[model samples]
Target: MWKPILLILLMIFIGVVGFHIIEGWPFLDCLYMTIITIFTVGFKEVKNLSPQGRIFTIFIILGGVGTAIFTLTKLGEILYEGGINRFLRRRKMEKKLKSLKNHYIICGHGRMGKTVRERLEEEKLPFVVVDNNEKKLLELKQTYRCLYIEGDAAQEEVLNKAGIKKAKGLAALLSSDADNLYLVLTVKLINPSLFVLSKAMDEEAERKILQVGANKVVSPYKLSGLKIAQGLIRPTLVDFMDLIIRRKELSLYMEEFTVKRDSDIVNRNLSECDIRRTTNVIVVAMKKPGEDIVFNPSPDIKVETGDTLLVLGDKEAIDHFEKSYLGGIS
Candidate 1:
């Protein structure tokens, strides 16, 4: 693109200089004559030409006209290439968005929204991001290799384009409380069943957002304050949590699994199933349907259908336990 533009400028400069030197015309007249000759606009000359000037005009015609055509060709190629690439990219993005189902939709690409997206990516979950900032969305697409839509997330049409109807969850992390509130409401109207997590800056906003069909509302400032207090109060406990949550140095992890009806250990107790002997994963807690979670459930407690098990151990052991006794539904 720059190459053709520079070529055009160079050609113009050469034509102006050549006309001034060869025809000895005033600067303005020479410039006008050069423009007419280069473009071949069929305009009459400003003054009669001498033999040398006529010969010089012929040279200008050959070089300047050819350069103009070359520049126009380059311009056309640039436009065609750019237009087709944009068209193809948009088509590809639309196709991918259409094929996504049970995926998460992120309503912003700000700090909290970015964190949520990173976590979902780590979990190998499918998700799409929505934001009104085109440059930011382009950066995200390039850096994270993620799908995104450039539009206001608070609008119903944008949410629909993000496939809110088919999404299992949505995170409304818009910049303002009013925006988040409106987005949550709009999302519920689009898909009442979608689990919405939103960000709020104040208690009142959090309450209002929750009332507007948001399943969860997080206040970053509140969480940060609580975390600071906890870290000072019980540093060891916080460190332990951080270790497990990050799983950077330690292979240990905590995971939850749902017990399906057809699993072999559905009717069996913990001891009867012998999950520890088989996979070395401990049952940290279990929640049966319509019941509160029971922490550190006894070995005699029987495993039942629709039970959610929260276990802690090495990732591989936990995976093996899931496959062997927990119906592999994690």
Candidate 2:
């Protein structure tokens, strides 16, 4: 529309100027003649046309009519394709969100939220994102091929739509600490056992979020500062630890398991329990109820029900231990 309008205006300008120069006609007459000629109205010319005026009329008709057709075609194509593509994408996201369960909901798409999403992707965890910024949410959906909800995460309705009640965990990384606090509190109220990790801008905010029942509170600035110091002090050790934490194949996660009362290994020593012999996992530490953790416990240390074992091994070994001793796998 715009291009065609501009083209017509330019043709009129040329015609008016040409008539005034060659035929000595007034501006109004030249303008009237230009409009009638371009529309093929075939009205009488304002005055007798010189050969120069006839040539200018031919150029005007060619340029104006072609531009009008091109502009209309492009506009029609945009309306036809863009609208349908947007609708289909929205429908797909809705369907994906509806079927989600045991999935994570990331409240923000900022730095912390993006990092969390990447880590979850590395671990093959399912998740959906929520952000008030529609452009950012669309960008995330395109980049990660994940479902996203464009809304305020602190709102109860938005949380419910994200399946907060069925979610296994959530990460609150909204720009404002207060918003994260509100989200944590709301989620906790809705599902008391849903694990939540939230970001805090400062120590006070961190404490507030924890008080609101967030399972963990992370401060990116503080954590980054500590990481920088560790990198300088123990670069090699830090690198090794990062490898383990970031590795996907080994999946060597540190999981704590509490011995069950009826387990067969309830009264056996660590060596006699045969976790190392049977599952090839190391019991790095043991923490008795109400007691501090003991690291690298001696093999002779007695394993009892209610003692929490901090084990480190690949997923396969962990699975074997959970099945053989814990009675069922997590």
Candidate 3:
């Protein structure tokens, strides 16, 4: 903006001074002549001019027209590239992120974190990714439309921007163990109620991670070896579970839902709730807070708040059960 203004002012000054010196016109008359010439108004000159003045007017016109065209072009590019449209889109995204509740935050975008995000998408869960990798963010934007903010995960400001206070959970999957530990600690301090999951690089880090308030710690290397071992002995069982869980096109998948405080099913026994009869969904297990998971819970077990129900059913059935039974708390 300043460039075009200064250039045009310099051109006009040169025109005015040259005309005043060459034609010996009054200062006002020279200024008027300069303005008319630069604008190509074709008005009559203030006074009859020498040949040198006409040549100078010709130069003024050329410079003024060139500067005007350049200014307009640069202004157009600025408006198109860094103007209101980009700002509005960014504001819209920020507003949406702020309004998110019960959404998960993924603190890294490495291989493990990307896989976690894919699984979340498969389950139709909302999530946001926080990382400092511009290239990874660009690639993720192309492939996934979930909310993402680029920043240091260990920083409270970044977590607050991701709505950690309202977020249901967060996963710390940064490359380094120290960073993940710091990220987990920060999240716990910000929202102690929020469930935290962190990735562990070393076996010794798992205990430290739990002490730092991570509810669960995942180590991809450890899980891969277990899966391989399971496949060797329980091949058919593994295939069956995979067929049910991995094949989303099928009518069955495993899911979990939290029992809310005011849910209708709270304090009611499983048989009384009659989940299978009403929703045609199986309640595979239930875990009370600080209690062991009761696999294939009995009909007489009572539901309670903070209990997580592991269920297996179709997507629509799960949604219906969650809404109608969980009291729509989320």
Deviation in Å, model 1, residue 279 alpha carbon: 2.0
Per-residue error at 34 for model 3, in Å?
A: 20
lDDT of 3: 0.86
Worst ten in a row by lDDT for model 1: 135-144
* TM-score, every prediction: 0.75, 0.68, 0.73
Alpha-carbon deviation at 319 in model 1, angstroms: 2.9
Candidate 3 C-alpha lDDT tens digits along 1-330: 678778778877888789879888888998899888877788998888899988888888888878767776877877865676657766877998989998999999988888888889887888999999998788765543778998998888888999999998899999898888888888889999899999897988887998999999988889889888999999988788878867665678788888878888999999999999889899999999999999999999999888999999887888888888997625
| CA RMSD of all predictions | 5.0, 6.2, 6.0
lDDT of 2: 0.84
- Cα misplacement distance, residue 61 of candidate 3 (Å): 18
Alpha-carbon runs more than 4 Å astray in model 3? 1-79, 82-85, 140-144
As a whole number from 0 to 100, the lDDT of residue 247 in candidate 2 is 73
C-alpha lDDT score of every prediction, in listed order = 0.87, 0.84, 0.86
1-330: candidate 2 lDDT, tens digit per residue: 366557656777877787788789888998897777766677998887789877877787787566646666777777766686667887887888888899999999987787888888877787988899877676765553777888999899999999998898899999999889998999898899998999898899999999989988999899989999999999988887787777743468667888999877789998788788898888999999878899999999998889999998888888888888888864
TM-score winner, 1 or 3: 1
The per-residue C-alpha lDDT of model 2 at residue 74 equals 72
Clashing pairs in 3: none
The order by descending lDDT is 1, 3, 2
Please identify model 1 stretches exceeding 4 Å from their true place.
1-3, 15-82, 135-138, 141-144, 289-291, 326-330
